[model samples]
Target: MSVTRTIPYLTIPSTSLKRGFYIGFDTDTLTTTNELGTQTIDAMAHQHHTSFLFNANELYVNEDPENGGRPPRVNENGRWVPPVYRDGFLPQAPGRMFRWNNGRIEYAGSNYQWFGGQGLTYPNNETLQHYSSTTLFWCNEFTQFQMMEADATTIDIATSDFPYNRWYPLTFRYERTLSRVSASVEEQYLAGRDGAWIAQLGLQAYRHRRNRPTEGLAGNLATIVALVAFSCTDDDTLYNVLINNLAWRGQLRVYDAEHGRRPERGVVSNIYLDPENPNGSTYDALRHLEWTDGPIIY
Candidate 1:
């Protein structure tokens, strides 16, 4: 009989609890260290600080030219980057997701800047009110599935587990499910690549740099799938969303509904799953909770 090993997996937030398995293995030979050893560390240090080091998230941007544009800002093509450092602030404190949209300019020592109403030179308030606000889009099923479609390129399903087509996987995921209005915002710092972590982008919310803690102004709710690993695809040519943000999801659904009058509820009674767990309850629950239900029209 082939014995199926059942490893009791704990959620990310569970390691720090008083009564639970607090164990890990470091198989790195380093410069000169033991290859195998079971390490039991402290609750606060291991759970709150160190374990977060390896976790990663991506950030993508849409930059507008350094001149006249829409009020708040315009979302455009910059590319994706990942593994942001925890600022030890609100979102990271409570552990959630946050997205901040801003302007990209060749500024002093930094390429990106969050346009808060300062002067026309620096404290320009008019431009600030107009182009300083951030908009949040609900990540629905439409957006999640759309990540798989070939956007002018063929879909490459390399992992065969997580659904990512093109090199970039643009979906926000939460360790826990989020209610409709829950939100968090953070200023994106930099990405570590090559040898040095370069300053590429920064993020801001409805309010600009007033020293207000970005933590609570937007609640403690977490944000997920903020950015994906960016890989070079084809051209510098960009597509502008003139009117609607509805791209592939709506169009494809409409096409399928019209041509093929499919049944209302699809059937899968023969689907096999361990009766011990019964149904894809746990898995579906996580996906329904963490992943956005459909396509976000932003």
Candidate 2:
């Protein structure tokens, strides 16, 4: 008879965020032993912090030479450089801006100068109002399954028994303000490299109203929030062992007083592993949250 045993491998942190927020993931190593001997593997965890002014509103000026040309350019070190003009202005809206700083992706914004007294230059307020935010937490861990010989002479391990394509549970929290509102969360699964949705997960919807914590002379002073949690493991057939091109896409919709039912934002995260070799994997884990899409009510 063959015997099987299970072991706890990793744990992902629970995260919470206000309108403007930040989150990160880091890796660690662990070693475990069984009848087949001991092995080491990499584990990952998440952390969250308040991003005061990191991802503030972005700014873009009309770069068309036909539209009075472009502004003077300067590098990060304040060095002057030749101005590069674009055919048209980039979209000026609530969206995530990615920049290559050092070796990692850094969130940054464009700068615009404001002049005050005595020809002095001052920084203009370019911060945009956050409409809604989504927070997601998940984990990607490595596990090994092997078979051993009773006499410690010959052993065999089949890769087919390995859970190469494990589905990590997804927990999403959404928040928006202005008035009492209703929200819904949808999950999408992308099948192959072509990036087509093979199936759509069921959606869960709820309504929330702001509640005040302290007694005030005014009205309520609380923030409305909603939480949605589900596990992809419920559908075992959706788990693919050979190809690891599986992706999870989330869309949050909220009822707006002016816009009715509209999509606040959509997020895409997935895991990729070489089908033939599971050791080579690219885990596109969730890094941060942004309220970059939605109607601006300023």
Candidate 3:
């Protein structure tokens, strides 16, 4: 049997300068066994979660007097007038412009043409281009999408047969911490005024178990993976970022209808830029931490 559930739409708080949200899985009820042959469960046990942070300031609205306000528009003479700046900052240039049509927001234009006809240019006079029209493409969108795709994404587990083929409630929550970290705090940390270089931290874990046991075996094996991603929305995505991951393979010894056994073993890997390392190397200090079982007994 298969079941599906959609978490109600969670609104990222508009009041938050740095809008963000989190999706997490709870597997505390799932049973597991340690080397001692005892069963145990914890909130972090067999859990999977992910947090997403986006710059709300990047979102812009068009000016339409018919809708609410007058926006900059092109005149009959073919001269371009810029739209009203949001929060005193002009909408990101060379990107798709969204507008309201009959009370519905929709894509209006792409590859904005500024008064200069060359689109918007940066301080260095280089042209700013937005490659995606349907999706916003600021701050390594492709990389973020790729990372999510490579991992056990939220969508993947929600649709999978893991968690004992039973239904479980998914939770979504919003937070503003991603944009709230002050620049002074970052400077202090990077300058070594603070003991730690971590500005913000997020953790996620994933686990997968086969439905049926192999022939001649009492039970099946489960695969688990966890990730720790660092940096907040305040950090520049073009520069530095780090992700630490731990993977584990475990055995599920099901004795009968009600009793089962679980034992796990795992490894860790990391990805980061040289400058992003808090330990003054390409690897973060967390990467050095490890736990392992000496040898497997049959």
Candidate 4:
């Protein structure tokens, strides 16, 4: 006589059942691993949990309008002209703005001024070609800059003159995009001030020539090699599914030179080869597998 064994399949329903969202998976022996949790999550459900949160201030429209109204005066074009303010002072007038064809600032209006600091051959009267100021720039002042000339040296940014004649200002930094809903936004995270990782999904692999590190290749190779030799390799493969701000589920595997890529095609069968030594390492073979409706959620 022969006996038959049956397995249980689970259908995961979305929060909004009317939307017709679902995912189906089959179990090996009707036994669920503790890592999967009692209730497995659905991909759509996880997406819904994270979609509602976003920041609004990142856009320019959310900023407050500039205060201080325009000044009063009639220009040739029949428009009310305003005096421009400079450094900390504005022209003396009933209204705040005034016009000037002078030094560095051209027109004065309210709390600001404009300057056209281009081309010039000073009349025999002007002494210096460049002018620099502590608070602002003018045609007549000079502001000094520091440069880094040598390989190993500490540079001070506060000094006016270059400590080393050959160095120039260079910057190295990273940035990331963030979404918020008017609240819960911070400068550090958005600017990538420290070592912050931007949120992203998918697998990343680095491939380099066995003998040459200078010129290396990346992508597809690492995945193909790992998948084919999974049995021989220690489980160093890492897979993650993100739902909401938290990582609801994840799997981690590691591979070193000692344990190499295994020749296999399926994931589940290879993972279940040695039941007696569930936690011990084993060499197994895999066939093929597929996912249709949604991401594999544990």
Candidate 5:
């Protein structure tokens, strides 16, 4: 018989939480060693921050005549030097964002995040089973399945089982299913490539500068520190993964329905997630919580 193992990825908010997890603080007083500190930050964040100020979602801009109609910002082929970072943020707070509470996918991000504005009645006796990982109930099935597709099902599947594709067996995993952060994110961060642990593109950021806890309008600003490692890799790489995932879960993005999207149900069982669903229907491992949504159109 094969032994199945399970590991918990969600760390409860507390004073003793490790660097692996980040909890948001609305207060001004903050203390941490990993607060973007003196170490360099990825240039992607700077580009994104600047674009956000200009109300532009893309980095593409008109060629500057100073450089013969091709500025350094524009690449050799006249393409935006760095791509976009399109993933949304899920504030790591209680009842504020998507979470795994008491072993179930709780949608408190908002009514829109779950069902959307009023007038749509809730599904009668709805419960969904297709969470990404049975061991880690918080994960969404669509993103997990997308990751599986990207990795060719070799990374998310268990090490004990044989994968048909050429791949590296993961040392950190939860049961047969994979943890998005530990399994894939960690592997990518530590890949020993140009951008893994060190800044490859030469975009260095300082915690003291970006956060400016003492400089911003509201003194003591507790900024939302990025918690996921996959994002720290490279904006282009992150956007690439996000773009691919969109084919499967595009409308589910919040920005299309709302603005500023991290994605709520993208390509989820968006139409519905009931026992009758052919793909993301209910299973024995799932709790009683069904989602009936309208087609999110731009």
Candidate 6:
């Protein structure tokens, strides 16, 4: 059954949930193993408990009304504005929430996103066991996302069998439609949440990828293959109601390798493209020349 609640955002000050809410699996299909707690959590109710009592703190609206208020049109040119605070912020922000328990953060959820379907992006991981996950791109900043598989194995980018390197800014949530609410309502998650994720994943993935790469990929540059590799791994999980398990072969973005495109989105997915492949050289047509070493993973 579909559920609805009042939109939170008393202010950007991170208010607490006066009336604690419930977060649990709607069904018993996906793996609830990773994140029984962290945001972007997609999983079945652990041990037959369909929902968990949650009290969220640090919940605020970080999205901007002028920048992208979702649906972008009250009717062509009427301008549908989100309720702004005294300080000027919207209630539909992503990646800026903290899960509270007993007056402290039980989980901290954050993530990086691109407005249009673009570089180094992937789905949100549905579990809390894994940290530093992200998800795929949207047609515009107006569209919100949801986790497809709640419990997806974190992709071991280091493994030889796997195609890409697993780095920071992980994409774990699946790209999806606005099914939870009307597209007109925008990205609303009961009061302290948005869709399957509590919030867009934070800097854990960014810090890992930008600093010390666990997969040994120290200096990755942007590449076509790296787009969907960013994620919060569970190893990972999100969509398709029947546990719509997915492993993508290609992406839908505005880059064409044969046509020669450059990084338009603000992320880079690979260091050296392929650490082992010798054909990688960016200066030939690569956007960032500093990373013009290594071979293409594709």
- Give the whole-model CA lDDT for all candidates, comma-separated: 0.19, 0.21, 0.20, 0.19, 0.21, 0.22
TM value for model 1: 0.16
lDDT for 118 (candidate 3):
27
Question: What digit string (tens of lDDT, one per residue) describes model 3 on residues 1-298?
Answer: 1111113453234244232322322233333334456453444433322111111112233455565544554435544322222221223322222221111222223332222322332344544332111111111211110111111211233345543222111111111111111111121111111111111111111111223211111000000111111122211220122111101011212111210111110111111112211222212221221111110101
Residue 107 lDDT in candidate 5: 31
Clashing pairs counted in every model = 29, 1, 1, 35, 7, 60
Off-target runs (Cα >4 Å) in candidate 5 are: 1-125, 129-180, 183-274, 278-298
Those runs of model 2 whose alpha carbons end farther than 4 Å from true positions after fitting are: 1-27, 41-57, 63-85, 90-283, 287-298
Candidate 6: deviation at residue 133, Å?
17
For all predicted structures, in order, the TM-scores are: 0.16, 0.18, 0.17, 0.12, 0.17, 0.16
Question: Distance (Å) between predicted and true CA of 74, model 2?
Answer: 31
What is residue 176's positional error in candidate 1, in angstroms?
Answer: 16
Task: Estimate the lDDT of model 2.
Answer: 0.21
Model 6 lDDT per residue over 1-298, tens place: 1122212332222124233332223332332223344333323242221111111111122244566432232324443322112222232112212221211212222321222121122255222211122212211223222111110122322342422332222222111221111111232222122221211222121222222112111111222222322222211221111012222211122221121111111221212121111122223323222133221111
* Residue 173 Cα positional deviation in candidate 1, in Å, after optimal superposition: 14
Error of 1 at 166 (Å): 22
Per-residue lDDT tens digits for candidate 1, residues 83-151, read 111111111111111111111101121111122111121232222111111111212222211122111
Model 5 clash pairs are 28-220, 41-204, 41-205, 88-262, 126-290, 249-267, 252-266
Error of 5 at 51 (Å): 35
lDDT of 6 at 233: 21
